[model samples]
Target chain A: MPLSRVRIVLIATSHPGNIGAAARAMKNMCLDKLVLVRPRLFPHEGATARASGAGELLENARCVDSLEEAVTGCRLVIGASARLRTITWPLMTPRETAQKVVSHYDETDVALVFGREHSGLTNEELDLCHYLVNIPTNPDFSSLNLAMAVQLLAYEVLLASEEVTPASQQGQLPAEVEKFEGFVQHLEQTLTDIDFSDPRKSDKLIRKLRRFFMRAAPDDEELNLLRGILSAAQGRKSMRRDETSKE
Target chain B: MPLSRVRIVLIATSHPGNIGAAARAMKNMCLDKLVLVRPRLFPHEGATARASGAGELLENARCVDSLEEAVTGCRLVIGASARLRTITWPLMTPRETAQKVVSHYDETDVALVFGREHSGLTNEELDLCHYLVNIPTNPDFSSLNLAMAVQLLAYEVLLASEEVTPASQQGQLPAEVEKFEGFVQHLEQTLTDIDFSDPRKSDKLIRKLRRFFMRAAPDDEELNLLRGILSAAQGRKSMRRDETSKE
Candidate 1:
C-alpha cells in the first residue's frame, strides 16, 4: 500500500520503449506504481520487451488522458526539472525531495512527475507541483535521459525508505572537522613559513585553500599524509632560514 | 585537455535523435569528448535539430567502428550497467564513480561507456571496463535514458573537479562523521527506550536506521533537530516507565 502511495507519472512520453524503461526503472527500485499521461504509444511490443522482467508494472500502469487526472488526489507532487524556467518555483535537489516524499509516505499520496523526452515539463505542468525537484547536473550538458532521471529519483526514494543500502563506504572515511581543521592550519603555516603567502595577507589564500580541500574531500589518512608533506615543507623552510641567518 | 580526455562512448546507438540528445547532454555539462561506436545513423537532420546549441560538439564528434578504438589509450575505463550479471565487477555508484573519474582527470584518459537503446552492453563488451558503474534504481524498473545517465554522471564530474558549484546548498552543511555518529547513537537509544527495537536484538534495526539517515544525509541543524526529537521521545518513555513501576 505504501509502495503504491509513491507514484511515477510520465507526461506525454513519446517513445513507448521509454515508458517501458521508466516502468523498469521504477521496478528496479521496488516501485510498482506508474502513471502515464497521454503517452504517444503504449501496449507496444518495444515497451514490453524493454521492460524485461518489469512487464508486470507496465501491465498495471495507469494510462491517463491528462496530467491533472494523473495526479488527482495526490497531496504531494514533485516535478523533475532540467532547465531554469521563465517563472522560478521552489526547487529541491533530488536527494532532499526524495527524503520529503519518503517521510510523508504514510500520510499522503505522492507523485513524482516527469515531462516529455524532448521538451521536459511545461511551465503549466510544473505549476501543479508543490515544489520542483532539480537534479544537480552539468550546466553545459544538462540533458538527461527521461528514464535515467526517473531511475535516479526512484533510487533516492528507495534509499530514503530504507529498502536498500549501498554496498559500503569501501574503507574510505569522510574527513572529520578536527582533521580538516588541522590540515588547513598546517597548510597555512607551511605557506607562511615558505613565503608562499604573507601571514598578514593570507585570508584570501586561506579561503582558496579551503575551497580546494573541500572540493577534494580528502579522507582521514589522506589528510594526515598531506599534513606530513606540509610539515616537511615547513621543516625545509626553517632549515633554509637557519642557513641564511648563519651566512 | 582533461575535459577532452574524458570520453563519452555510445556503443551501437540506434536513434539519431538520441545521438543528438547525448551531444546536448554532454555540452550542457561542459564535456566535449564524444565517441560513437557503429551508430545506426549519423549526420542526420533529426540529430542536428536535437543538438540545438551543441552543434559544435556533434561536429567534432568521433565515429569509430569498435569500442577498443574509441577507448584505445584510456587509462581508466568505466561501463554503466542497469542490470546485474553472473560475474560481478567492482561497482561504484554514479556519485562515487564520477568522483573517481574526476580525480584522475589531470593524469590520464578516462572513458564512460553506455550500451545501446535496446539491449545494453554485452558481456564481452563489458569486459573491457576496469569497473562497472551502477546507478541505483528501482529493482523492478531500472530503465534509464542513455543521455540522462550521461548528464547526471557528467554533473558529478563537474562538481568533483570544481568546474562548477551547485546553485546552493541553501545553508545546509555536509555532516561531519562525529555529528552523524552522535545522531545515530541518540536515535538508537530513543528507539530502545520506546520499545521500538529490543535492546539486545537491535543491531540489524540500528544498521537499517543508520543507512536511512546516511542516505537522507541531513545537515548539522537538521541532525540536531532530529536528535532533539529523539531526546524528547526518550524522556517521554522514561516518564511512562516510571508511572508503570509505580502502578
Candidate 2:
C-alpha cells in the first residue's frame, strides 16, 4: 500500500539517461511516482533507449524547477547522500530509512530526493530533508551511481512492504516463566544432594548451565522429563545416605 | 572476503552511460570487479561523465569480446533477469542470490552476469548461469534499469557479508533434551499424587503443558526450582492421604 504513495524525486539531473534509468528503477520496485526538479533534458531518445520498455514512467514523470515545488504536499522527505557533511544531519542506513518510509507511506506521502550527477544535493537541499540516508560503501572508492542508489532504496522499501513473516511468530507458544522456575529449584536441590554440585562453589557453574538451558528454551514435556530425572537422582541419593548411616 | 573474488559481467552494453553507472554502483558497494563484453563504446565521454568521480573504476574495467571469455575463470555465475522464461530455471530473489554470492565469494570467483539493455541475456547466455537472480518488482510495471539491478544485488551482498550477529549465538548455550525430560516426569507424578490431574485423561493436558514449557525453555536453576515444588506437592498429598485413612 505504501508503494503507491512513495515518490522518487530527482534534483537537477544533468543526463537524460539517468532520468530514464531512475524511472526504470522505480518501476522495478513497483514505485511509479516520480518528480524531476530542473532536469537538463527530458523527452529524449537516449532516455527512451535506456528506459528500455519503461518509457511510460518517464512520460508520466512530473518535472518541477525547484526542490520546494517538487515536495509541496509530502509529509516525509528523505535525501540520499554519499558524503559526510560538515553540519551533521540525522543519518540513517538505507535499511533503517526504508523501515521509516514503509511505516509512514500508507498514511502520508514520502519523497526520496536524489541530487545531481556530479556534486550531490547542496547543503540547502539537504536541510529540506528530515534525514539523510547513507548507503554504506567502500571508503576507498565510494562512488555510487544515481540510478543505482534509487534502486537500492526502492528495493529495501519493497522488501519491507512484503513483510516476510519471522520464524519465531509461527504458532508455537512457550511455557510461562513461573512454572519453569519451579522445575529448576528441585533440580538444583537434587544436584546438591547427589554431590554433583557443591552449593558453596556452584554459582559460576549454575550461571553457565543456566545460560545453556535458557538458550535451549525447553517446552513443558521436555521440562517435565528433565524434572523427572532430577527427582529420580535425588531419591537415589537419599536412599544411599540412609544406607551409609545404617552402616 | 568473497567481495574481492566477485566479478560483475555486462554483456554487449550499448550505452556507455550504463557501464559508467554500473562501475559507480560497484564502487559504492565495495565491489571492484567489472567485465564488459563487446561494448559499443568504451573510454567514451558520456560514461566518464556519468561515472562522476568513480572514473578510476572505468579506467581499470576489463573489456572482452565474448561472454565465455568474460567469465572464463569464475566458479559461480548468476544471471539477472526480470522475466520468467519458457525453460524454467531455478530463480532466486535478490537477497537469496546475494547470500549465495557472499558465501561462495571467499572460496571461488563469482560472476553476476547482466545482459544488454534492449533484450537482457540470451537463452544461450542464460544457460551458462547456475541460477537466475530476479528482483521482485511490480508486476504491472517491472522495468528495472541494468545498473539499478546491479546496485540492489550488490547492496544485498554487502549486507549479508556484514554478518549481523544473531542474539542467540552471542551466548547462552541450550540445555540438553535428556536433562529437561527428567524434570517433566517428576512433575507429572506429583500432579497425579495431588489429584491435580487424572492419570488417564490428563495425557492431552500433559502434552499441551509439555508444548507450553518446551516453548518457554527455562534455565538450569529454573528447572531445579520447579522440581522442588513438585517434590513438596507430592509429600503434602501423601500426608493428607494418610490423615484421611486414619480418620
Candidate 3:
C-alpha cells in the first residue's frame, strides 16, 4: 500500500551520482524500498549532488554483495535491461511488472532490479527474475542508465494503481524522437555519401527530409522499418555512385 | 485503461524548448493532450527545435490564459511544484497525483497542472486544483526544470495507461529514456520530503538508494506501487512543512 515497502535494487552501480539519480527517480514515483548489490563506488559525492534532496532513500538503503540475497523473499523479480537475450522468462515492461506486483499485492515483497551502468543486467541476473523488463531504445544504440530505467517503470506503476476508468482511446502512438532522430541522422549520412546532398544545401535538404518523416509521425516499429528501407536504398545508391565515380 | 489520453497542462512556462521538451515528455509517456497557460513563449522556435519529433504535441498543444479555463471541466486537477506555499491544496506526490487523476478516469477529462520553473504556482493558482502535486527535491535546491516537471507527470500518465500491460513481454513497452530519467528525478524528490537527508550527505545516500531500487528490477506496476507510497508520504511531509513554515 505504501511505496516504501516496494524494494528497488541496483547491482554494481559504478557511478555514485547515477545511483543518487536513480534514488531520485524512485522517490519521484513514490517508491522507497532500496537495495544494492556489490556496488563499485557508493557513498560518493556525485550521487548526493545528483540526488539533491531525495537522499533519505540513500540513508535507509540496504546494500548486499549478492543479487540473490537482495531479492530472497520477493514474489516477483523484474530485471531491467537495454537488450533482449535468449534467456526465457515472461518478458514484461516495467508497467506490466508493476501490474503483476499489484495483482499479488497480497505478497509481502516485490522487487524491481537494475544492473551496472556500463553493461546493464547480466543474463544470469536477468534470469533470476520471473519477468524481464526492457526499456526499448533504438536497437542500434540502447545503452540506458540505471536511474532512467527505474523512472519509466515507476511512472507506469503509479498510473496502474489509480481509480480512473480510462476513456480508452488508443491514440496514434507517435514515433520515438530518438529513433526518428537516429533514422534522420542515418539518412543524412546516406544522402551525403551518394552525392545527393550538395554540401552547401545539405543542411536544409536534410531538415526538409526530416520534416517529411516527422509529419508522418511514425512510431518505433514504423521508424525502424522506414530506416531499413532507406538504408537499403542508400546502399544501392552507394553502389551506383561508386561505379560511376570509378569510371 | 490506456494512458494515451491524459491531459497535461503547463502554466506560465518561460522557455519554448521546455515546452517542446514537455511535448516530447508527454509523447514519451503516451499522454498527448498538452495544454499551455500563458507560456512566456510558445510556437517557440527553440521549443520546437528541442522537441525534435514530438512536434505534434506542440502542434496540438492547447494554449490558454486562466488555469480554470485550462481545466474548467476536468474532474481532477493536480498541480506540480517543488516549493510549498502558505496556502494549501490537497497535497499529493506525482505518483499519488497520477493515481488520483486516474481514479477520476471515468471522467471525460483529467488535468495535471505544472507551474513555471521559477516560482511554481501562486496561492490563487493552487486553489484551482483539487490536489497539489509536490515534486520532492533537494531541500536546499528543489527546482526541477520545467520540462522535467512535465516529464514526471507525463510519464506517470503514460505508465498508468499502457506501460503496466503490454501485449508482448519480450521488449520494453516503448517509453522514452529521457522521460524515464525524469521519473528518477521525482523519486529523489521523495527523500527531500522526509527531511532526513542532510545536504552534505545527501548525494551518497541518494545514490545508494537508487542503487538499491534499480537492482530490484521492478516492473511498471511494482515501480508505481512503490512510488505511490513514497510520494504519498512525501506529500504529507510537504504539507506539514508548509503548515509549520506558515505559522
Stretches off by above 4 angstroms in model 1 are: A12-21, A38-56, A65-68, A86-88, A115-127, A138-148, A162-164, A168-247, B12-21, B38-56, B82-89, B115-128, B138-152, B158-247
Stretches of candidate 3 off by over 4 Å are A1-5, A28-30, A83-87, A103-108, A135-145, A155-247, B1-27, B30-113, B117-119, B123-149, B156-166, B170-247
TM-score of 1: 0.56
Candidate 2 docking class: incorrect
Residue B18 Cα positional deviation in candidate 3, in Å, after optimal superposition: 8.9
Residue by residue across B8-44, what tens digits does model 1's lDDT show?
Answer: 9999988787788778767766788999999999988
User: Global lDDT of each model?
Assistant: 0.71, 0.72, 0.63
lDDT of 2 at B173: 24
Put down candidate 1 lDDT per residue, A40-108, tens digits, no spaces: 988899899768688898889999988899999899999998887767688898779988998898899
Q: Is candidate 1 or candidate 3 better by lDDT?
A: 1
Residue-wise C-alpha lDDT for candidate 2, range A137-188, written one tens digit per residue: 8777665767778888988888788767231112233356876777767766
